[model samples]
Target chain A: MFSGAQVSLYPMTDDFVGVILKAITALEPYRPDFRIETDDVSTLLVGPPDQLFPAMRDLFVTAAGSGVHCVLAATVSRGCPGEPDDPICTPINDVHYGQPLEERIAAAIQQVEAAPKTGQIVAAQFSLYPLGSGHHMDEIYGCIEFLKNSGVFDRSKNFCTKLRGDAGAVFATLSEAFLRFGAPQGHVALDLKVSANSPTAV
Target chain B: MFSGAQVSLYPMTDDFVGVILKAITALEPYRPDFRIETDDVSTLLVGPPDQLFPAMRDLFVTAAGSGVHCVLAATVSRGCPGEPDDPICTPINDVHYGQPLEERIAAAIQQVEAAPKTGQIVAAQFSLYPLGSGHHMDEIYGCIEFLKNSGVFDRSKNFCTKLRGDAGAVFATLSEAFLRFGAPQGHVALDLKVSANSPTAV
Candidate 1:
């Protein structure tokens, strides 16, 4: 299966140019592992789904370490037909879809528990879109149930579900939600926002 | 009807605290018109649906004018049962939601065309969810049709539709999309991101 994301970082400072440039270097360690491109709107990162959030966490941690507030907005997707299938954009795991929903939930939880800890506590929110699914809501509800036990699950917000924890688990939880739920071959989209070192974070 | 949004601004600089404080002052002019609260996570702006975007634009423009890259993340919603009805959060316009879908589309376009121009250009993307709408994808597709002709439509992005234009028209288009589509009384949610003054802008 194919996986990738379109991400943009906004830094609130006069030296934003400097900040953004410096932050992306955090992704350098992951280079050649993914095809990355930066455009006027957002940067495109295509590669293994497992590395998507870890790469993002490294980048944001660098930005946040500047002792400034930074926000990352991203749309993570897997199995979207609109995107061209590139051999480089392949999943690292054996993803056998059509497994029973309960099994997927158990596997997803195990994955979250085993995620590497980034040690950077962050708060994130996301809304899942399971397009073309015959029973999208069922898929959504199932995901929600899995999130409640995902260790990082925060609370139910007005529109999106919230998650807070070490950057590693938070992102791992998100990756699982995006990849494991919804139709196996249908398009699934995740609207994701992550924040680090915010003054308002409780 | 209850209409409001949860918004947060992140400034990437050592002076993020100062920058955020300075920017929120812009919303001072809109005060008393809405019930606003700021917390560790975000600020809640509850008021007439029409003023939601303008208020955000004012706050964002102020932050962007500092000659830095700033990004705003917001989730706007109307008529969610989870929220309590507040007279303070009233609709400025006579929203007859049950009107024909075509009529709603026309009115939405007219609203965008008549929007007050903020003179600042910004790019925004949002995904609308008509939670209980039996035909949610149909509603999404219909919203897409309206957006193509919205004058501010930028492109069909992977997960969400993109809009770029004067802050006024761009936000107006977003407001219309959030309010006009989906089930009239059913729960509807929008996940939104807006950015300005980015060095990466083409």
Candidate 2:
């Protein structure tokens, strides 16, 4: 059965939701074995992951159709807001693509260590997506729970993630975290530079 | 004068490139300042930053216009391929957007940091966007040079980059790096999930 998912599109912060809506509408012609819906913020299409791929291709091809050029982001899922009927309401670990928050937190720490500048640790800020404002601490604590529950690593000491390594390592670490969280597949905008104390390698 | 920056989109894999291309094509109407040039493995779009933003918007709209959504990686830049008469033949500290190899490497780091597994440390497996195809080391080195020269942060020992506090600081540091070496501003797509990791104070 196709999992019901809420797919939202962030188009550089604009009321440009119509494009995706149009694509979703176009899917009707394909006779997909799934139910699809569209709104201003996202297009919720329901179907097996396999079926979704082809329908998505058609939508991408026509809407983002060739000869046009632009950047984009999208998501797919099932379930509705209100109450907690959807499996997504539960912690990510409980979901199909979910990874324990502890795993994510540990990954963040390891990411810091893996940075190209592993020895010289500096200012680093790690965050979980969709935690929303006024709730970062609560969200972080939840992550700790996942960590403790999962016998992957021990959170014996006060574990705070600090970015280490060179620019390369720092950037690499960030990517891993996003993937682990099952970040909505989208483009990545990155900017990184080497430290001044480093050699004149450039 | 308009900055003729070259923007190249490098998807994690060749398969992903097709989707990216569709997103770009959909953006064509909006991105008047730039022109798209397609190569075998990548697509190059040259234009100014002002126009690039909207173009990027369209691209993301188109991608989100589809169903696959995520911000795996994205970048912006201020330079383009050098002319034969160009004095430096691409300045050692120069950063441009047309290059994909450098951005891909940077993105690999980002994925590592964001993923919840692998300890968030980008293993060699995820070190390069197009894994196993070694090329563009010089460009990567160029980015390192640009980061060091650009006075975006304080020079701390190790791989530390001193910036303002929290989100602003990270944003600023990344902005400088992208403006100098990133491709035209655009939305990137990747799979991301927002989860609460911390436990609430019961």
**Candidate 1: pairs in clash:** A11-B12, A12-B11, A12-B12, A200-B40
> In candidate 2, what are the lDDT values of residues A1-202, reduced to their tens digit?
1133333322221223454456456577644455555432234555443344334434544444322222332333312111124322233222233545665666555644543432322122232222112333344455444434332222222112223233334434434443344222221111211111211111
Model 1 TM-score, all chains together: 0.84
State every prediction's TM-score relative to the real structure. 0.84, 0.23
lDDT of 1 at A173: 93
After superposition of all CA atoms, the RMSD between model 1 and the true structure is 3.3
Candidate 2 regions with alpha-carbon error over 4 angstroms: A1-202, B1-18, B69-76, B79-81, B84-202
Please state the error at residue B191 of candidate 2 in Å: 20
Kindly list the per-residue Cα lDDT of model 1 for residues B1-202, writing each as its tens digit.
Answer: 6778888887656677788889999999889899887766678898987688788888888887776666788877777654678887777667777777788888889998998877788888777766644477777887888899899998876556778889888888888888888877766668777777666676
lDDT of 2 at A121: 21
Q: Model 1 over residues A61-174: C-alpha lDDT tens digits? A: 888777666778887877765467778767666777667789889999999999897777888888787765447778888899899999999887754788989988998899
- What's the DockQ for every one of the candidates? 0.36, 0.02
Q: Model 2's A-chain: what TM-score? A: 0.32
Residue-level error in angstroms, candidate 2, position B138: 23
- The residue-level lDDT of candidate 1 at A7 comes to 87
